[model samples]
Target chain A: MEQLLQQLVNGITVGSVYALVALGYTMVYGILRLINFAHGEMFMLGSYFALTLIVSTRVGVLQLVPNVLLGLLLVFLFSMGLVSTVGVVVERVAYRPLRRSTRLAPIVSALGASLFIQNAVMLTYGTQYQVFPEGLLPTTVWRVFGVEVTLMRVIVLAISLGLMAALYAFVQKTPLGTAIRATALDHDAARLMGIDVDRIILTVFLIGPALGAAGGIMVGLYYRQINFTMGWTYGLKAFTAAIMGGIGNIPGAMVGGLLLGILETLGAGYISTGWKDAFAFVILIAILILRPTGLLGERVAEKT
Target chain B: MSRSRGIALFLLAIMIVGVGGCAQPKAEEKKPAAPAEPIKIGVQGPISGQWAFEGEGIARAVNLVAEQVNEKGGVLGRKIQVIQGDDKSDPKESALVAQKMVAEKVIAVVGSYASSLTEPASAIYDEAGIVHITPSSTATKLTTKGYKRFFRTCFLDDRQGLFAAEYFSKKGYKNLAVIHDNTTYAKGLAEWTKKYLEERGVKVVFFDAITPGEKDFTPTLTKVKAANPDAIYFTGYFPEGGLLCKQAKELKIQALFSGGNAVNNPEFVKIAGLDAAKGAIVTTEPLPGDLPYPEAKQFMEDYKKKYGDYPKSIWVILAADAMRLIVTAMEKTGSAEPAKIAEYLHTQVKDFPGISGPIIGFDEKGDRLGTIHKAYVVDDRGEFVPAP
Candidate 1:
């Protein structure tokens, strides 16, 4: 029972990050019906961007940080802002031209963009994995009923939930949200209704990657290690999470990410750690077989 | 009529191959004669990619040895000429590097560092009857392929596993939890270590592998924590090993954390942080940073003087050890022919001293003989201090 509880804690922590990254893939799929394959790399960019800000060679950025909490908040917002800008440029240069082409073209473009970004980071930063600077967040751990709870775990969970809540509110409660949803439902109809479909899609590309970047920074802080090629694995898991949760459903991605994390962690803890990924995929296959559309169904646009 | 046409086409294809074979020059084998041109020694390793520093290290080390040998006196009345073959630390590229070395007719070749990269290159060199000595690749299966000319100055992974098992027992640790990353090298080491421990009647309470590229091992460590072993031995590369150490400390696991040679890296301490890394014991063959013999001090100074920096890691000096063996064999045989050099070293060489240690030599399996494994504990200063 203690073991189960411990793994649940571990799973939920990992799942939160997966959920954040999964949102990018889900939202992009929701609107454009295009899987943003480059979404994972944006998570990597977020970590690297934050790292550069914290420790630039020309000047020690740590000395510039005024206080721990404010410094971390600033780092998170600043890096996510930078990554979102990069995301917009990527959509403008790479995906925008292929928007009218066959669906396969944009996916291939996203993949190419992923490769280009991954390699560019490798060339710029070199291949050595960098450690996240310490003292940004409290590293204290407390034991409750044989389960270790680190302070950072609570903070990460809070940040992810906060972002998700804000995003959910923005999408469901605002006129801009309805306009975005309308554009997702039918591009021609939305254009006729003066929705500015191009701007809406651009907004999605911006929002999705920024969320992924935030996930990246969160993961880097919690894990305390970041590397250039981390995206391939993190991206794979996030894509799996998005699909499992019903690819185009926003809320489904959230539940799926957390669920997949818990399941895989329990699977590794109980069944066999070596076959953890195999176990996760096997469960995914079972879920998909039972529900072809996904857990919640791929809800592209809800009929108002 | 169609069958006859098919037969005619097949006959033509054979005739074309026969013509092509006839047009090519026959593969040449050197006969021992009066030396004229410089002796060609090939250096094969990653000149690019993630482990490029290791490849570059092998080159610098080999060249330094060659310079030392030539300064004393040219081998077999011929100056040693070093030819580099960049494998790019890739198995596909490793084959091309081997082919290039064979084409250059190098008397012996050193390197293609990682086990995956070296295995392919070793096959090519074996076929060409050119001696290839890897400096640091430790996969147990590499030497079992029955290649006459393939040798390694480094001990096999099983040897490392044995050294680790003995250490655990000597330290009075009976129950152990062993973790691996499921990589070929790590898994092999873990299995062998488990076997050795079981032979000593030590209970392996938990045995499993963690997924690579994972940032968290809390669940896996939690499971191991439940098992409540005397110590936890992680048989993986430093990246995951370092994280496991950090997380294990966070969980406040009472068991000591230990690992084999792959975790014996400065980067291990850097990743784990000084507080978490302290007291972690690592089994490693002597690194350039921890050279056991007096000659190593001079080697370091000379290397720094020539290269403008100390070697990238332990691999540089290990490559130098391989180069010195080849040179010694050539000097003893009084011949630059590869066959003679390989034969003399296999039969006659014993207790050869290397810069890395007091004595370095190979057994029948082309594995380095004698137990050279040193256990080092990460001290508070973040340096790997030799554990007494």
Candidate 2:
């Protein structure tokens, strides 16, 4: 029972980051109906930016940021800002030109953008695992019901869950969120209703990458290692989460990400560790076979 | 009249062809022993990927050796030219590098860092009748494949594993957990260690392999903690090894953490952090910084003078020694012919001085003899000091 509880904690800790990246996939697919393959690189670049800010220069070479939490917040904001801008640029350059063409054009463009960003980072940063500085935060551990959890895990989970809640609330209540949904439903009708569909799509690209970047930062803090190609695996897994939960649905991304994370953890813990990666794809295959529309059925994704 | 004209044209064509054929050999004779003809030696390895540091170490080592040899005099009246082939430490890229080496017509190649990569590459070089020698690849079957010219400068997995198992027993760690990343090198080491430990009646409480390149290893570590071994032995490269060390420390698993030779890198310490890396045991050959041989010290001094830092690992020194071995065979034979060099290496080339060790030789299997592994522990200063 204790082992099971610990595995669950591990699952949730890993899942939240996937959820964060999955939000990018879900949002991009929701509005533009374009799977932003480059979104994962945005997450990777986010980590790189944060690593540079903290380790390389430490926020304009000021060693003391008054408090570590404030310093971390500053790094997060800066990296997310940079990556979100990159995301918007990617949309304008890669997707905007081909929006009028066949749907396959954007998909191919997304893949090209993905490879371009990955190789760009590789060439710039060099192909090696960049180690994140450890001990930025304290190593406090808590034993709740005989399951040990660290301070970093708690912080990451709290921040990611908090971000997901804020996003869910905004999508439920805000007029901007409704505009996004309307534009996603019917771009022409939404434009006729004065929604500025292009701006809405830009907003989607911006916010999605911002969340993915935050996830990247969290992963760096937790794992203490970042590389250029890491985004691909994380992105593929997060894409699986988005697909499992329904690619175009918001809450579905969250649920699917968490569920996959837990399933992978428990599977590795109880079953064979060698098949850990195989477990994710096995579930994906089963989901595709059983429920092709995903856990939360997408709302009229078909284009007329 | 047309038939007579056709017969005359055929006769004229035969006379011109005969003259051209006769002139070809005289043209080759005209360039006999062209002054300053360079000896091209192919150096293949991962020069730009996850293992780029290792590749750079190898490349610099071979070049330093070449520069030193050239400074003395040209080998057989020709400058020793080093041609580099970057494999990116990938198997697919390795085959391409081998093809490049073949196309460049290098007499011999000293290359490829990992076992899986070296396997594919050696096959290509062997097929093309080129002598392929690896400095770091330790998989046993590399020599067992019956390739006449394939050789390695490192000890095999079983030998290294046997030494590790014996070392653990000497330290009184009877109960152990063995882990690997399922790569050819790591898995082979793990299997050998497990076999040797079982032979000595040591209980392997836990055994598993983790997927490489993925960061999170807590799931596997959690399971190992449940098994509650006296020690944990990780057989994998540094990137994942560092993470395992860090995560295991975080989990508060008190088993003595140890690793195989692939984990003997400064990057391992950097990635694992000071707190997690201190006192960790690593089984490896004599590192460049702490060698007892005269050739090794000279090479280290030369390396520092040339590059301003010590080579990344002992494998770098071995790579340099591989270059020396190939050059030695070429120099003693006084010929650049591959067949003579291969025959000389097979029959003679024993009791040689290597940078990694005092004595180096190749057996019938082309495996380097007299190489030994030492167990080291990371000291408080992050140095891989020999364990007492």
Candidate 3:
């Protein structure tokens, strides 16, 4: 029972990261209906950016700031800000130009962008796996409800949930959120109603990548390791989470991400670790077979 | 019509000139070989991916050997030329590299760091009747293919796995868990360890495999914790191995964590951190520094001076020794022909001294006759030292 509870905590912690990244997929697909495969690379770049900031500050001008938390916050902000710009540029260069050409064009372009970004990072950083700077985050393991949990895990879970809650409130209560919703519903109608559909789309790209960057920074701190290819596995899992939650549904992505994480962890813990990844795909297949549309997906009537 | 015909003629003339221009340089270059032609040896391995460090390290050692051989009046009075083929750590690319080496007519090939990459390339070399020596790939199935041309300097997974299992059992570890990355090498070692442990009346309480690049192993570690084994054997590369150790310690799993040669590197300690990595035992081919051979010590110094960095892994010495072995075979046979060199390596060469150690020739299966394997544990100082 303790083991089960322990895995549950681990699953939820990992699931929150998936949810954070899944939001980026759901948001982009919501507005642009493009998969934005390169979003995962944005998450990877965020960690690299934070790594550069932290390492660069360790010996130079920023070393005067002895407060680790303050330095970490600055690094996080700079990384998220830069990664958000990269997300916007990716959309503008790859997706925006092929907006009307064909749906397949942007999807293919996104894949190309992902490869380009991964290789670019590899060339710049060298291909070796880098150890994320140690002592940045406390490695204290806390006992909660008779289950062992790390301080890093709690921080990751809290930050991810806080970001998700903020995003939910912003989408539900704000005018810009309504414009995004309007644009997602009907691009032509949103533009006709004087909504800047392009700007709304750009805003979605920015918010999604920023959240992903946050998740990236948290993963680096929690795991204490980062590499160029780390994004591929995380991205694939997050993309699966998006699909499971209904591609364009925000809250659904969150629930789906957590569910997938829990199921995978439990399956790995109880059944076989080798089949952990297979469990996610099995659930996906079962879901697709049982309900053609996802759990929260809406049925759109076909026009004759 | 006349103007179009003239344009076609002009284009055809340019094509002929282009074809002739390329052929003339090749003929001219070959004409100057009045003496013995340089022996060509192809070095194939991943040069630009996750495992690029291993490949690059091995390639540097191979070049170093070639330079030293040339300095010693060349092998058989002919300069040794090393040609490199980058496998990119992919099986398909490895086969392509093998084909390129065949096309280059290399007398022998040294290479391919991982077992997965080496397996497919071995088939290509075997069919071409070229001698192929792998410096680091340790999968037992590699030799099981019965390919006469294939050989490896490193001990097979079964040998190392048996050594580890025996050590654990002798240390009174009754129940153990086995984990692998599902690669040929990892799985083979895990399976061998499990079989040997079971045979010794030791219970393998838990067995699992994790995806290669997955960062989060808490779920898997949680399961291993539940099993409550006395020891945990992880058969995978250093990156995942280090992560597993860190997570296992974080979970407060008190079981001893051990692995194969993949965990025998400074990077492993760096990733796992000193506290978590301490006492993590790894079964590996004895490092040159650890070996008592004076020549091994000299080779280490020479490697550092040439590469500007100490050899990080045993693959460096293994690669250099492989090249030296091939050149020695060529000199003994008085020819660089693949068939002659293969014959000499398979039969005549017995206890040939090289930098890493002595090559006691090869078995019928092309496995090295006698490869020493040792167990090392990460000390508190973050260095891998011989386990007491």
Candidate 4:
């Protein structure tokens, strides 16, 4: 029972990270109806950005700043901002140009963008893995309800939940959110109704990557290691989370991310860790078979 | 006489003496004749891919050895030249590299790091009757393939697997879980470990194969947990191993975890987190770092001076040693001919002292003979501290 409880804790921590990354996947897909493959690389960008900030500022200039939390906040903001610019540029260069070409064209472009970004990262940083800097975050273990949780895992969950809530408010209540929803419902109709569809799509890309970057930064802090190849694995899992919740629904993505995390963690803990990957895939397959549309997704009629 | 005329006269006298000296070497006191062409030693490895670090280290170490040999009046008066080619760490690429080296007429080929790469490439070398010595290949089947030309300066994975299993049994870790990457090298090592441990009356709770390069390992860990094994042995590289350790810790499966040489990396400590990696044991070829051998310290010093960082693996020194052996054998045989050098290597390579340990370049089957393995635990800071 203790072993089961322990694995459950471990799974949930990993799942939380997956959920955070999946939120970006779900939100971008929700608003734009495009799977932002480069979102994973965006997460990678966030990590490198945090790494850069940590190295340049904390190690170099921020020696004068006595408070650790202040240093962390600065590092986090810089990472998010850097990744935001990259996200915007990726959309402008890769996705926007193919806005009207065809659905296949944009999908292909996103994959190319992903490859391009990963290689660029490889070239810029190096092919070898870099260990995350030490002492940037607390590594203390916290005991909760007879279950062990690390300070890093708790931070990852709390920060991710906070961002998800903020994203929900931004999409549902704000004018920009209204514009995004209007455009997502009907691109042509939204355009006719005086909503700038292109701007909305751009906004979606911007918001998604920024959130992804935040998640990425959190991952580096939580895992204490960063490499060029990290984004693809977590990104794939997050995509699975988005699909499980209904790909284009914001709330669904959140639900999907959390549920997938818990399920994967609990499943791996209780059932079999060897079957963890298979179990995650089984959920996707089961969902696809049982409900062609995801939990929150509805079938849209094909335009002839 | 004027200054210019006197200088010209002196130069003319020196030129006559220089010409006289060139023609003075006669029958008895003459040095051996320099060969018409340089003796080419082929250096094959992945110089530009994932395993490029190891390849570059191998090539650099070999070239350094070649440089030292040439400075001491060259090998058999013919300068030893290194002809390098990138294997790209792929089997097909490695084979092509071998064929290219053979076509170039190299006296001997030196690398192809991983056993997978060496396995196919060695066949090409064997067919061509070209001598190939792998500095780092550790697969058991390479020597077993009846390739008379093939040799490695390290123990095969099976041997190390047995060593790890024995260590576990001696420590009384009776209930064990075996997880291996589903590769020929990893699986072979894991299988050998399982068989050996079982033979010693240890209860093998689980033996599982995980796919290589998969990111999430929670499911596998969960299953290992289900078996409730006292210890776990993983046969995979640090990338997945680190993540597995991290995930395993999170799942609260506190079984003592160990791995093969693949996990003997600094990246493992950082990736797995220090707390997670604590108490994790790994069995690998004896590194020059811990060995008290005299040459080990010298190589570490020279290597550190040449490259601004510590060498990644202990086998790199052995790689360099193999290069020295080939050049020395060529000189001893008084020829750069492949057949002569290969024959000399077999006959004269007994009890050769190298950086790793005593290396007999050829056993009965022409495989490198070495018997040194070390066990280590990752400290809190991630450095591999030799086990007490």
TM-scores for every predicted model: 0.85, 0.81, 0.80, 0.80
Give the CA lDDT, 0 to 100, for residue A56 in model 3: 80
By DockQ: ranked, best first: 3, 1, 2, 4
Q: Which candidate is the best by DockQ?
A: 3
Models sorted by TM-score, best on top = 1, 2, 3, 4
Candidate 1 docking quality: incorrect, acceptable, medium or high: medium
Q: What is the C-alpha lDDT of each candidate?
A: 0.85, 0.86, 0.85, 0.77
Residue-level lDDT tens digits of model 2 in B230-252: 89999999999999998888888
Among all candidates shown, the one with the greatest lDDT? 2
Tens digits of per-residue lDDT, candidate 1, B123-144, equal 6677667788999888778989
User: For residues A1-304, what per-residue lDDT tens digits would candidate 2 score against the true structure?
Assistant: 9899999999998888999999999998988778888988998999999998898655434557877788989999999999999999999999999988998999999999999999998998898889887678887878798877889899999999999999998888999999998987888999999999988998898899999999999989888889998899899889999999988899999999998999999889998788887987799889878988789955474675
Error of 2 at B219 (Å): 1.0
TM-score of chain B of each: 0.85, 0.75, 0.75, 0.77
Compute DockQ for each candidate against the true complex: 0.63, 0.60, 0.66, 0.31
Model 3, CA-based lDDT: 0.85
List candidate 1 stretches off by more than 4 Å: A57-65, A188-194, A298-304, B1-132, B139-142, B295-312, B326-341, B358-361
**Model 1 chain B, TM?**
0.85
| Tens digits of per-residue lDDT for model 1, A1-304 | 9888989999999999999999999999888888889999999999999888766621224446656667777788889999999999999988999978998999999999999999999999998888876555667999999889999889889999999999999999999888888876788899999888888988898899889999998888887788999988999999999999999888989998998899899899999888888999999999999997789975333443
- Using TM-score, give the best candidate's number: 1
The CAPRI classification for model 4 reads as: acceptable
> What share of the reference contacts is kept in model 2?
0.70
For model 2 the local lDDT of residue B192 reads 92
Ranking by lDDT: 2, 3, 1, 4
